[model samples]
Target: MTSQAADRPEQVASRRSKLTREREQEFFDAVLDQIRECGYDAVTMDGVAASTRCSKSTLYRQWKTKPQFVAAALRSNRCPRFAGIDTGSLAEDLREAARAAGGTSDKDQGLLQALGHAVMQDRELQQALREALVDPEINALRDILRRGVERGEVPADHPALEYIPAQMYGVLRARPVIEGEYADSDYLVRFVEAAVLPVLGLT
Candidate 1:
């Protein structure tokens, strides 16, 4: 066989990999948008393939099941939104974090709400949700608290330190359930100022 013939298989695989990568985001976006529009149960592999203009077999080739597909999509969209927030003060850092979270709260909360009990049944989906949405912000918030302790703004052993993440996350998830409204930017900022700041003994 000629060298060209020998290399054709490798070239074909490389091109296939590139094509998969290029279409990956399109698939992810379609599934997420569908989840947002219709709850998780309503989002199917066939629906996603139709939305993305790909074959159902193509989706199955990429991910074997709807849960696997959604989990992969969530993992692919991982963005550490609260990373790199430092303002020389824990109060300001938290305020900035609230602003950052509030910016995407509606969409994120909607996804979580849409996923709802479906995530409870699937460990992979649960992990993907936490990795994509929950863990990064919690880690970043803890880092902010650690910096506060180092700066002597808050004592290292302060009782409230451990609960900060819960408090922040709780409010975001709770406000809508309580009042039928999202915890938007202004509401989050005020929460940071009135509730969170006071707990930390900050102005």
Candidate 2:
């Protein structure tokens, strides 16, 4: 029954893949919702499992801990908005990216707050967060800058073009902690107009 044995492995693999995908989605939704409703210190794998109708054992088996699980959650939520920005100018691009970065999502914000202390202690989780959320978004913006260079909208030698994404992300991430303020559109717009565009000589 070699054929039967091979078929069984394939079937099991497929089933496991499906289960993993479903559970991961459930876990991410549960984590974000729980973090939004409760503070970072208050969220737990047990709580997430109960909310998502999954076993705590399953979550532990997959992620090992809440920090690892949250790291995975952050990675899953990354979306690039590069294609939406087009004002036919470098100023428009920076402004567009900053504005987009500033609009804070409640669930995502809560997730970040919840992961704060955990991220400090967990290197793997921090790397995962960078890989999942930060890197892709930054890479997309970098691509935008590269395009601007090709179009001659921004010079290849411009410092602002090279550093705009960092400025955008740094402020977007740190503004809340720095000023105890939400990362709103107004702050991002001001940053773009005041600091970012000025560096680019766009204003």
Candidate closest to the true structure, highest lDDT: 1
Distance from true location, Cα of 4 in model 1, Å: 18
Q: How many residue pairs in model 2 have overlapping backbones?
A: 0
TM-score of each: 0.91, 0.79
lDDT per residue as tens, model 2, 165-197: 787778766876888776777777888898877
**Residue pairs that clash (backbone atoms under 3 angstroms), model 2:** none
* Residue 121 in candidate 2, Cα distance off native in Å: 1.8
The candidate 2 region of ten consecutive residues with least summed lDDT is 102-111
Cα error, candidate 1, residue 162 (Å): 0.4
Q: Kindly provide the TM-score of model 1 when superposed on the true structure, using C-alpha atoms.
A: 0.91
What local distance difference test score does each model get? 0.91, 0.74
Any runs in candidate 2 off by more than 4 Å, and if so which?
1-23, 105-109
